[model samples]
Target chain A: MRSTKPRRWGERLIEGAIKSTGIATIVFVLLIFVFLLKDSLPLFGHAKQTASLLGTRWLPTSEPEQFGLIPLLLGSLYVTLGAMVISVPLGVACAIFIAELAPQWLRELLKPLVELLAAVPSVVFGALGVLLLGPWFAKTLHLPVGQFAALGSLLLAFMAIPTIVSVSEDALHAVPRALRAGSLALGATHWQSITRVVLPTARSGLIAAGLLGLGRAIGETMTVLMVTGNAAVIPQGLKGFILPVRTMTATIAAEMGETAHNSTHYFALFFIGLLLFLITLVVNVVAEVVVHRMGREAK
Target chain B: MSALPSAVGRTLTQTGEDGSQSAGQSVAEEAFLPTCEEVPCAPNILRPEGEIKLEARSLNMYYGSFQALRNVSMAIPERRITALIGPSGCGKSSFLRCFNRMNDMIDGFRLEGDVLLEGNDIYRRDLDLAYLRKRVGMVFQAPNPFPMSIYDNIAYGPRLHGRPDRSELDQIVEQSLRQAALWDEVKDKLRQSALGLSGGQQQRLCIARVLAVQPEVLLMDEPASALDPTATFHIEELMLQLMEHYTIVIVTHNMYQASRVSQYTGFFLMGELVEFGHTEQIFETPRDKRTDDYIRGRFG
Candidate 1:
C-alpha cells in the first residue's frame, strides 16, 4: 500500500491570511506617510509656489498665501500638555481606587460607569465643554468668556481618564497574588502591601496606560473645536487659555472646507494632520515599549 | 536544653480583629484537635521531662459544621523530638501548624481552647503574633523558598524585625544554616536562586530559613515527604542534632520515620487520638487496640 501524505490546505490558507494582514498593515501605514508627503510637497519642495512663511498672515485665498503651521503646532502641544497635567494623576488615582480599595459591589458598579465615559462620543463631550466648562471657567476666572484651550484640556482630561483607569486597573490586577500574600505574611499592612508590592509590580503597566491616554488626548478633535475658543493664537493667560486654542486636528477640520484648492492654507492643515498621525504613532510605540518592559520585569 | 515554642495558642489571639476569629473559621482547619481522651498516654505523659515548652489544654477545632478535633489535650517537652504520626487526613499537620499560629493565615480559621507557650497564654488578646512567630518558626511539607537567592532566603527573617547590620546578618545566616545542617552544602552557592537547589537541599534551605528566625520550637509538617531517601535520612540526622537544642513537633505519614526519629509518638485516627507514649511502647506495646492494628498494617 502506498503511504498518503498530508496536503495542509487549511494551514496554507491560514498562512496566506496572516501574510495578507501583515502586508495590508504595512501598505496602510505607507499610504498615509506617502499621502502626507505628497500633500506637503509645496512647502518642502515646490519652488514655483514661492513660499514665504515670514511675511504672509496666512490668507490662503490671496495669490501668494502663507501656510505657517507654527501656531497650530504650539496650539496642539499646549492643549495636549494641559490635558495631561489634569488627567495623569486623576486617572492613576481612579485606577488605584478601583483596583485595590473599592468594595466589590461598588467597584463592579463604578468601573462600568467610568468605562462608559470612554464610550461617550467626542462630539457630546465637546458640546458639554462648550455649554458647561468653557463658560464656567470664564466666569470663575474673570477672563474672556469664550471657548478656549482650557476647555479643550478639560474635555480631553475627562475623555482620557477612562482609558487610563481601565488599562491601569488591569495592570494592578496583573500583579501576582503570591507577592501580596508574601508581603502580608511578613506583617505588612494591606496599604503597605499595595504600595510596596502591587504598585511596584504594576509600574510598567501603569506607564503604558498613561501613554495610551496621551495618544488619545493628543488626537482628539471635536471636543477641542466645540469648547475651545478655536482661536489660532497661542494662549495669553489662564482665563484667555480657556478660550479655544486651535489644535492640529482643529486646523484640518475647521479650514479644510473653505481652503482654496492647491493653496498653502490647505497644505498647512495636511502638514498638521501628518504631525498628529506621527505623534499618535510615537505614542503607540512608547506604550508598546513600556508594556514590553513590564512583561520582562514580571519574570 | 530548653524548650520554647513561640506563638502557640493564646499568644496569637490578637489576630482575632475584624471578625476573623469566628467569621474566619472556614479557613480554620478542623483536623487539628482530635478527641485526645480516646488515646492512652504513656504512663509518664505527665512525667515532665525537663522544662515544659508547649502545652495544649482542652483544645477543640472544627471546620464549619464538621468537628475535626474533640477535647484534644497534649504537652510537648523541651529539647525533645515529639512526633505526631497517623494515616492520611489524621490531623497531624493541623496540630503542627497550631504551634506557630500559622493557621491564622488560613481564612476562616478559629481555635477554641488554650495553648500555653512557656507558661504564657499565647491566645491572649494583647500578644503580638508577628513577634511570636519570630520565636517559633515552621517548615512546610512542600519546599517553598521565596523567589530569591539562597542567601536571601536564610537572611529574610533576620533582615526583617530590625537586623540591618550586614556583618551581624551574615553571622546569623551562617549560624542558622549550620544549625539546619545546610551550611557546607550551600556555602559556595549562597547567591544562587534557591529555586535552583536540589529538592533535599531546598528542604534544608527552608530549615535554615526557619532557623534564622531564631525560633525555639520548630514545627515541621512532613519536612521529608517530598524528598528522596537520602534526603530523608539527612533530615532525620538533622532532627536528632536539632533535638539537643530545640523542642520539635513533627507530623509525618511514614510510621517508621516516627519510630526512628521521635522519642515521643502519638497516633491519631478520625479526629481522635488513638495512642501516645514512648516511641518503643507505642510501636511495640500499644495500650490501645487501634495502635496495634495500625502498627500491624490493619487498614489504617
Candidate 2:
C-alpha cells in the first residue's frame, strides 16, 4: 500500500493544454459574436433605414438612400420556404428507405454516399448551382438574368437535404428494436410498425433535423450570392418568385467589398449579417428544444 | 385421458364440412386432424384439454451453423399460465419468440416443423405474420417503452388499425394501463413521457402497451428478470391475473417462480423439452430422470 506512484509531467501538461484549447475555442466564438453585434448597431437608428426592414426597396446609399429590407426579407423567406418544401420529404423518405426498407447491401452502399454529401464544400455547391441551375432557370422560367430566387432555393435544398437525411436516419435507427418487436408481436405488419410506432417515436428527432436543415438553408453564403440575382427590386408574379432576389447572406457578401468604413451602408450590411446570425441561432435553439422534448417523450 | 374431456370431439365435428357429413366420412376427416390421443374409436369430439390453441409439433430451429432448438414440441393451453422453466441457453426464450415469429428478424435463422395456432400453420407463406404477432403479443426481458407519452404508448395500437374517436382512445389507454396493474400509478401522468418512469414501471408500461392491442395470448420472455424482487413479484401476480383472458406463456429460470405461478410447467434442457406436464407433477414426481436432475440443481 505504501508503494510509490509517479505521474508524468508531460502527460499532465498535454491534458491541460487540450482542455484549455477547448475552453479557448468556446470563448473565441462568443467574442466574435459580441464583436459582430457591436459592429452592426447603426442600422437600428439610421433615419434613412427607418423602414428598411419593413420597406420593399433595398437600394442603399442612393439619392433617396433606399435601405428598406422588406423585399430582401421576402426574398429570403421565399427561397427558404421553397428549400424546405423540397428537402423535407426527400430527406425523410431517403432516410426511412435507407434505415428501414433498403436492402442490407443497398443501405451499406447508400449510407456513406449520403454522408459524403455533407462533406462536399459549400462553395463548390454554389459554383455548380450558378453554372447549372441559374442558367437553366433564366432560360426556362423567363427570368431577366440567370441568377434568381428559384435557382438559389434549389441549390439550398440540395445543401440542406444531406443534413436532414443523415440526422433523421440516425433518429429512425435510434428507435428501440423492442418497440418494433412489440408492435410486430401484437400482429402488426412491418410497414405498420414502422409507420405507426417507429415514425411517431422519431418525430422529435425529425423535427430537430428539419430545423437544422432550415438553419443551413438560411446560413449558406456563397451559393445564395451566386444564384440569387442580387436584384433590389420587388419581384412580380412567377418572375418575382424566381427573380434575381437579394438575400441576407448575398447582401452582406456583395456589399462588404465596396462598402466604406464608418458609413451607414457598411453598418447596414453588418446588421444584415447580424440578422442572419440570429436567424441561424434561433433555428438551432428551436431544434435543441424540439429534440429535448422528443427525448422526454421517449422516456 | 383424465385431464382431457370429450368436448374436443365437438371441435372435430366442426372441422368436417358438409361434403363428408352426408357420406358418414367424418372419421376420415378426423384422421387428417392429427393427434396423440386415442378417441375411443369415435371421431367427432373436442377434449377440453386437447383443444390446444397453439402447438409446436416436432419443432427444430437453427441459427446459422448453430442448433438453437431441437424437436421442441409443446402444447400451450387456452387462458392458462404455462411457465417454461430452464437454464440460460436452453432455448426457452427462443421457443417463446417463435410463438409470434419474432425470430424472423434474425438473419440466417431457419425453423422446421409446424407451429400451429388454432390448428392453422403459422409459418405458411400465405399466413400474414403481422396478424400472427397481433394475436400473440410478447414482453421482452428488458423494459422498452416507445418514445411517447404513457397514454400514446397504449393508444398507438388502436390508432394504427383505424381511426378511433377521441373518447374511445382515452378509454382504451386507461383500460389497458389498468389491466397491466399500472393505472393507479400513472393515471394522472398519462400524458407524461414514458421514459420518465422507473425500470419496473417501464416494463409494466410496455406490458400495458402490449395489452392495448387486445392480444389473445401473451408471451413473456423473462419479463420480470430485469426487475427488483418487489417488481418481480408484482409482475408474477399480474401474469396470474392476465391468464383469465390471455393465455400466458412465461419463460423463467426461477424454479420457485415456475411452481408458484404456472398451472403447467415445461422444463427444457439443451434445447429439448426435458419434461412437460401439470405443475404439481413436474415439481413432485417428474416422469423423466433429466427433469428430476434439473429440478434438483443438476447440470442444465
Candidate maximizing TM-score: 2
| Candidate 2: segments with Cα more than 4 A from true spot | A1-8, A42-54, A138-145, A235-239, A293-299, B1-49, B166-178, B184-189, B195-201
How many clashes (backbone N, Cα, C below 3 Å) per candidate?
Answer: 31, 21
Worst 10 residues of 2 chain A by lDDT: A44-53
lDDT of 2 at A110: 93
lDDT of each: 0.75, 0.80
Query: Which DockQ-derived CAPRI band holds candidate 2?
Result: acceptable
DockQ values per model: 0.14, 0.44
Q: What share of the true interface contacts does each candidate keep?
A: 0.05, 0.80
Worst 10 residues of 2 chain B by lDDT: B39-48
